[model samples]
Target: MFKVIAVAGSPRREGNSATLLKAALAGATAAGAQAEVVYLNDLSFRGCQGCQPCTADDTCRVQDELTPVLGRLRQADVWLLGAPIYFDGVSGQMKLFFDRLHHLTNEAGQLRKMLPGRRAAAIVVTYEDKPRDDYREVAQRLANYLGWMGRFDPVEVVSLGRLGPSDAAAARPELLAEARALGQRLVEQLAQQGRTDG
Candidate 1:
């Protein structure tokens, strides 16, 4: 029963998305969460072919990088998906992975039982020049999609946007505080469940 599963959906290993996610994951770990981080860039996977085999077999027929990772994701009590926004949306790699999850969704279009009874959270980091809610639009849509397919609405959505190297350099204390808070929130939720499932 792992407490939380953190997915780093950035193509670049050391990209901003991964960096911020690490901060969040560090927080979760400090709060006593047994967290495993999956770096999607290291996995070899293709976009979903739209075949309905998983519906019949209750598993994806096209096995590749996602087979084991999806299993880990299914067993997790909380899923923390972190991705960078590109061109006003999630990165291509992240979108491909989510699209592949279609195979695991029930015929009625709900998330399969494998992912039921869990909570999801989205951590999106962007360097958008504008300070508007542009990132929130995409983040909420992602959270909504997860709610529909994963059967678990998000308990929280954290956005670290408009940040530059300067922020990380000049405001380390504030950044660390946010990271700790994120971690504490994740662990508190899992502890509320009284145990880990994945």
Candidate 2:
């Protein structure tokens, strides 16, 4: 049982979002939890083509980096989705990931029976300062969608706005602590429910 699985939605390898996510993973590890990171940039995921073919088997047959990712998401305890806001939404790279999840299910708009009981967390970073509600709005909607599919709602959502890649290091003291606390909270919650993975 893995403690946590973090998926990076940023296109940049060491971007602000990815850096913060790594800090979160470290915090989870400090709490005696295991963590793994997957970067979307390294994957060969094809954006949703709207073929509507996965409904037959309830799985995407195009077969790429996302195949194993979906399989891994099933067994993961805590999921960390870190993405930078692009035009008030997540970048296209991560947007494709979300789209693929939709395509992974059936025509009835119902998630496959394989998805349920999974715990997740959302970390949204943006260059837009002044604390915009876009990230929270989108993240909450995403969480609601996941909850409808029977996946556990995220224990907390972190919004770090108006940050730059250079500032990520300096923001470590504050954001890093938030990310760490997020990790410990998720681990404790999952453990209390007998989920040893977190």
Among all candidates shown, the one with the greatest TM-score: 2
Query: For every candidate structure, what is the RMSD over all alpha carbons to the true structure, in angstroms?
Result: 3.2, 2.9
Off by over 4 Å in 1: 108-114, 151-154, 164-172, 193-198
How much is the lDDT of residue 97 in candidate 1? 82
Expressed as tens digits, the lDDT of each residue in 1-198 for candidate 2 is 445888888877677788778878887887778898999988998987777767666676667878898788767778788888887788888889878776444545655543555565655555556677776787667666555444564556677766866456346687778777777777766667664232
TM-score of each: 0.82, 0.85
Clashing pairs for model 1 are 2-198, 27-183, 28-183, 75-198, 111-149
Give the clashing pairs for model 2. 3-197
> What does the lDDT come to for candidate 2?
0.71
Q: Count the backbone clashes (under 3 Å) in each candidate.
A: 5, 1
Residues forming the 10-long window of minimal summed lDDT in candidate 1: 163-172
Tens-place lDDT per residue, model 1, 71-149, is 8877776677777777778778788888877655565444455455656465565554555486777776777667655
The global C-alpha lDDT for each of the candidates, from Candidate 1 onward, is 0.67, 0.71
